[model samples]
Target: MSSFSSLFTRRKNKNRGRTSEKEIYDQEGIPKHYDRKLDRNLCSIQELFKQTTDYEEIHIKVGDLKGCVCYLGTTLNKSELNMQVLEPLREAFKQPETDAHRDLDYLREAFFPAVSYEYAETLHQLVWQMLNGYAVVMIDEHSKALALNIGGTDKRSISEPSTQTIIRGPKEGFIEDINTNIGLIRKKIKSPRLVFEDFRVGSDSNTKLSIGYMKGIVNEDILSEVKLRINKINASGILDTGNVEEFITDETFTFFPLIYNSERPDSISGNILEGKIAILLDGSPFVLIVPSVFTDFFQSTEDYYQPFFMTSFIRIIRYVSFMITLTFPSLYVAITTYHHELMPTPLLINIQSQREGVPFPAVIEILMMELTFEVLREAGVRMPRAVGQTLSIVGALVIGQAAVEAGLVSNVLVVIVAFSAIASFVSPIYNFSIAARLIRFILIIMAASLGLYGILLSLIVMVIHLVSLRTFGIPYLTPVAPFKLKDQSDVFVRVPIWGDRYRPSYLMTKAPVKNKDSSRPSSPDQNTGGKKEND
Candidate 1:
């Protein structure tokens, strides 16, 4: 048998190409030369604008000279650019000492006033500036092009995250702007140790992604691996962080998510503190956290907001809910259809009596009900919010009552299906719940084939797949399969606040403890002394 390394090396060598072909097609297929060439002689800014079709507005203004044109890529605050860029150039052209080449620096200084604006020396830098929403000013004889930083647009304000909503935690969520998202994380952490590394992934889109992590906290090897994977992602377009995540993820075929995604800044910050890397895309609200574990899906921001005991109880409930959601319906069918002796005598008799008039077998009954439920769910999601609620309530009542009356399914089966649906909803992550729903279908089929033995076989296969999976080299079943006691405080059971002094062990942090001062208040009167006295 060939080793994994040898096989991988052989594949790499087979796919290897010369410089020109490699530039066009990296390990991942992406054409490098998407942008049109910038002609040195061309003074028509409209020519440059014609190359990029993605931008909605590309305005060109001829100023300073017959050849000099100010090229604006986006529609953001065009009035300001007209005033700041074109106005100064017009004034300079009117002057007697307006030597187009000699007075260019002075004109820029007088116009921008802001110190950050700089001139692009190369064609690559010029193109990048245009892609980043900066207006480029080019002259006939000038060797350099001026890039302005006056990007101001009317965008949606930071709002509460629709997906990762929490009741007791911070209501603020990340917006589409990458800079704003980074700012939100910085506001929450307020630590200089946090590092934000920027990378441009897509060849055509040139979409900006910022990888955030704590300097000494994150495992260097894992961090490097994540960086390498991201750097190697050579796609033509990356509309969201989800695209980057899917491209860089270790497993593409698995149903379970390797990278944990969240829109809440607090959650991303928490992961960063735990030595996990977060990828924030420019146009996406959700940030992708690397080195995600299975247990991470079961956790929510509310877990930390509530008391440790309450959180622990809730965590236990979620774990139980997950199991019930996945196996309960299958187990019901397996025992009722094959292993009748496993059921109590009274229960078996009751089930048999109830199912007497049913037209379908146990497996068929389950499949029918599950399929109906899934259709209703999809309809509810796709419909308008107000109408969707009405549809769900009316549909559930109508379907349940009609099915029982028609004698297609037993009352016990109805109850079991309903319980399974409710159990699936108990999952904190909606994506995780969807995954559970898919896996439950497989489990049901397995149960139908070989009863309980098939269910056990499915479980073993699932466990093997999970154990083989890794998110940026961190095991998917981290702190559980590897059995890290320190991290177990927050997994399976939430330990007390004081007991969980360190961060998750899977991260391999240099300083695991987030708080040096773990002491509780000595007295309630310490900070509230004045209020107490006044009362």
Candidate 2:
């Protein structure tokens, strides 16, 4: 204990001088210019990457030029290094008096045939590139090094989206690689108007992220707002899009998610077509779409793929389910505790019979059941997939049966809780589903205190809160509270594709009409030309 305490004390003293001159030099970040001497550059890099066990340095000679290459073994592909850098340089040096090997520029232009390479004169540039999986080539007399992009291709293969499953839409999903994710979007749009702006967040982590939007279609002001919010993120490590979302969201205290995110590439492509901007993070599969409204969460990519009638029915069901998920437990508590007369006599008698021997009040019973279900859901998510599903099913059955048989919770409450759970699952977006789940508890508390009137009060408060919310300055309840009739075509009920001509009015898209030439096809009518081949 004494040794540990002393060690901690020493660490605190070391950090106490964190603002001192030497510490500032270390943390003030990499130098803008590289040292003219190769040995100096090598020494500084070696010290900087002292803790990196995979740091590798190799010595090589090129036509009387002495130099070294530094890179992280774990990050750079050795095969690429041998083929693109080592082999070419070795062959060039073998030519006794080759002028091409004398200069770094000639070496890169004539000798090394790498697809992409950049000159880095500054230590800051070299360090950043090296950290991002580039190999730094340091020539003896040259003031700069060739930063070859030899980043390893060690990422997960593209697979079907685990979440946001669909029946008739594209099977592809976004992976953790930002470039791959961008490529997926590109494959869908293929338009020259699509623009992706790159930004690096996290001062220490330096996580790369990109913002994609249609140049001519997206609102310029909204794009500017998105950039401003992203630039304002000053955190040291942005682990995922969730961190970025929180930093850039309009409201921090609200239960609802202001920015919508998805793992589906088609969903992102659809959002971009609608003039929304997508933010892709380097290490997260979920890409965030900005200026999301409440209606956006209820709709899915499948809605556009299927027939209008079928999609519209499913969309309406989603909205209905959302309401039930958010208010069912509260409604049950309110009706039983205070609004008993509002229920049908037969239903009331049935509920009373189930609750006959239950000792807890309606509020307690509802809370208990809700908590149990929430625990089961969370367990199913956290546990191993093989065991999770089976465990949750068996656990729910056992716990529910035991609770009901022991008269701890009524059978009617179990039915209500199950319905609420199922309804919550109906939301297309997981983040939105979480928001609904959390809001359900608040409504339950309100109902317990003030009954149906409490539920009404909570509803009014929630609606007002949602109305006040904004995503990148666009109202959350867009086309609903603001009431734009044209945008209503795909809000609650999806109209035919041809009729959804204009983009959402709130977006103020530069190009309003999605497809001006789009029109429904008509069958040929029976006429003289169609009369009969015999005539």
- TM for every model, in the order presented, reads 0.85, 0.92
Candidate 2 residue lDDT tens string, 35-76:
878888888888788887999988888768778888888877
Candidate 1 lDDT at 386 equals 85
* Candidate 1 residue-wise lDDT, 1-535, digit = tens: 1221121112232332212312422433222332222343242334455566544333333343433444444534677667766676666556665454354586577656773576766555555566566767765445676778676566779988988767898999999999899999999889898899877767666677889998878777677667667766777889997798787788899888878899899999888877788899998998998888899999987898898889889999999999999999999889988999998999899999999999999999989998998889889989999899789778977998899899998899889988999999888878889888999999999999999999999999999998888766567897888778767778887766665678776566677676677765445577776367677
Prediction RMSDs, each to the true structure: 5.5, 8.8
Candidate 2 TM-score over all chains jointly: 0.92
Task: List runs of model 2 lying over 4 Å from the truth.
Answer: 1-31, 526-535
Whole-model Cα lDDT of every candidate shown, in order: 0.76, 0.85
Q: Lowest-scoring 10 consecutive residues by lDDT in candidate 1?
A: 1-10
Model 1 segments more than 4 A misplaced: 1-45, 51-69, 72-75, 87-103, 524-535
The residue pairs found clashing in candidate 2 are none
Measured on C-alpha atoms, candidate 1 has an lDDT of: 0.76
